[model samples]
Target: GLPPLAGFFGKLHLFWCGWQAVLYFLVSIGLLTSLFSIYYYLKIIKLLMTGRNQEITPHIRNYRKSPLRSINSIELSMIIYVIASTILGISMNSIIAIAQDTLF
Candidate 1:
């Protein structure tokens, strides 16, 4: 004879163990990717900060030796955007994880 409520018990266990675990897994992956992006942005910032210059260089009003030419306003805005996206993305994903935990 089949036991009564076996299916319900099984589903409850899966919900508490399997789905919860998967939510955490996805959150961790998102966080790791965000951190990696942050690291890459910092590396670029460092390269731009410690670049070389010369006194006998060609005449120019604003000179930047980095690969992307001088650090213009647009470049600064892009760097800021990349940094902000990384932070915001991580935070939003974390909030989602928390919400899921609270809901279920």
Candidate 2:
């Protein structure tokens, strides 16, 4: 996920914990994999946003002016999810406190 997203916070906490525990190897591996996954995530986002798939046959591409038609509901939900994740990430300490209270 992006810097402002929930996944970034989750990974950050995980890495911090690993560092605190002195698990340097695991933390390094996790960080490396997370960085690698960003490329794939961005590629997927680009495809969704652009509605174009270069892998598709030219015949099929020509058949539809837009290869991937936009769905209003999906777009709306995506927007909502992104907003929620950003808000949650910013307020992560509150969430952690609540979770700790409930768990303990």
Q: How many clashing pairs per prediction, in order?
A: 0, 0
lDDT of each: 0.65, 0.86
List the candidate 1 regions with Cα displacement exceeding 4 Å: 1-22, 52-104
lDDT of 1: 0.65
Task: State TM-scores per candidate.
Answer: 0.30, 0.52
Name the top TM-score candidate. Answer: 2
- Stretches off by above 4 angstroms in model 2 are 56-104
Model 1 Cα lDDT, one tens digit per residue, 30-78: 5566568657766666656876434324654264557766677667899
Model 2 CA RMSD to the hidden true structure, in angstroms? 5.9
lDDT of 1 at 44: 62
Best by lDDT: 2
RMSD of each: 16.7, 5.9
Deviation in Å, model 1, residue 29 alpha carbon:
0.2
Candidate 2, residue 86: CA error in Å? 17
